[model samples]
Target: MTNNSTCNPLLLGNQLCFPLYASARKIVAAYNPFLKEIGLTYPQYVTMMVLWEEKKITMHDLGKRLYLDSGTLTPVLKKLENMGYVTRSRKPEDERVVIVEITPEGQALREKAEKVPYAMGCLINRKGNLFTPEEVETLKKQLYRLIHALE
Candidate 1:
């Protein structure tokens, strides 16, 4: 067979996913110092955000919202439960259903977390605010479109 790797469309640099993957990792890593101070990993912080908004939600629903599977979420929930940030239990009406609720401690964390986004914003802006607000919105919209299309 003739060699064609030189002009292959599947070359790493030609893929759209590489930049998205790298940027996502960089963005999450940039939040580490702030998240570390609050005693949460990125995944836990996001899970907590959903709990903060909903107060209480079923495990399945929470997983759906977080785009996580129960296998992955179970451990995060356990750690949060152990940390006193959330309480997880079986639903009285449906034993098979697990419900996660934010405790007073988790609510307290919300107050401290209020500054995290602003801190991350400052970090990104310090790196030169590469995208204008409108551009950011456009990028988000486009990404959402791609996500939905993939889904």
Candidate 2:
């Protein structure tokens, strides 16, 4: 009945998920100062990113794109709406469908956010970098593959 490290499935070090979770937290923390200056939390920033690109999209599609459920996404949308950055309204033809669109203010914020990726890139890929730009791209592709597979 002796415990063996190789056979210990419950060990934290044996879980692939731990590093992924921790790395996501660290990356989000790194984005905090820039996001703070923009007056958005990370979730809001990501939501706005999609809205900026799509200009308008349904709530269902936004949730699928962001990997968020309505329970989690609703509040984020509400806050963005309250900030006058976005507007959410029911579709006239389909009451059950809610559409989200970026407002003029939200579009203006995109100018401020334009610098965030560059700043984060410098932080992550400065001298003695943890990952090269190529490595980052490769990793991102791999992660997306994994996400698609999971879905």
Candidate 3:
């Protein structure tokens, strides 16, 4: 008689998505305090990033920039409107189209946020991480390029 045992344990290093997902969670959590001070959630912060780049855009354009659909952008935009950070209104010439414009408050908030990416960079660098600001921006460009290419 013989007995055999196997340990198919999934260790941290063995799981690819685990680290990526974990890192994202921790990074978002780290931004919580800062974002709270600025009246934003993770998604809203990303939304602000897009609006900061484009002064005014159609809802469709906003969705494209955020890689989200109306279902997602609609609610977030609504929240921003409630916060007086943005204005969502029907286009004057096209009743079917909604235009989103950043408000003065939103613009000011974005100015305040200019340092957020840098601060986040510092946090990531503290643990001997390989990502610096340049690497991070490059990576962002590459990922957005990939996203656009896929779409």
Candidate 4:
């Protein structure tokens, strides 16, 4: 009989999740400076990205799209509403469902946000950049696969 405790797969460095978690934190942190300039955080930025694309979405739908729950999303939506960037209301037909719509002010902010992707791309391609553009795309695809598998 072989005792395999010494060969444990549970070791910190041997687990896949550690690197994924660390990398996710690093990538989000990378957005801080630019997001700070625009008065947004990484979560807020991504929420706006989806809202920008969808125009208006039910809170349930937004939560699904963002892989977030209402508990996590409600405050972000509320903050955006307070910032005059969005409006949230209960749907008349179904009061249980809430609708979120970007404001005209939010529409105007899109022009300002247009440069954000380019700026982020530049950061991703900087001298010490961890991955090439192609590699980054590949990693994104792989991560999406992992996400789907987990789901």
- Evaluate model 4: give its lDDT: 0.88
Candidate 4 segments exceeding 4 Å error: 1-7, 128-133
1-151: candidate 3 lDDT, tens digit per residue: 1122223345555565687689779989999887887779989999988888898999998888778999988999999999999999998898999999999999999878887887877776787887666987998897677678879
Model 2: runs farther than 4 Å from truth? 1-4
What is candidate 1's lDDT per residue for 42-109, written digit by digit as tens?
Answer: 99999999999999999999998888899999999999999999999999998999999999999999
The candidate that wins on lDDT is 2
RMSD of 4: 3.0
Residues 1-151, candidate 4: write the lDDT tens digits: 1357546787776688999999899989888888888888888888899889999999999998888999999999999999999999999999999999999998888887778888877898786777777987998899999988987
Better of 2 and 3 by TM-score: 2
Q: After superposition, how far is residue 141 of candidate 3 from its true place, in Å?
A: 5.1
Which pairs, if any, clash in model 3? Answer: none
Tell me, by TM-score, which candidate is best: 2
lDDT of 1: 0.93
Residues 1-151 of candidate 2: C-alpha lDDT, one tens digit per residue: 3458767888888888899999999999999999999999999999999999999999999999999999999999999999999999999999999999999999999999999999998898777688877988999999999899999
Give RMSD (Å) of candidate 1 vs. truth. Answer: 3.0
What ranking emerges by TM-score with the best candidate at the front? 2, 1, 4, 3
Query: How far is 18's C-alpha from truth in model 4 (Å)?
Result: 0.7
TM per candidate: 0.91, 0.92, 0.78, 0.89
| lDDT, model 3 | 0.85
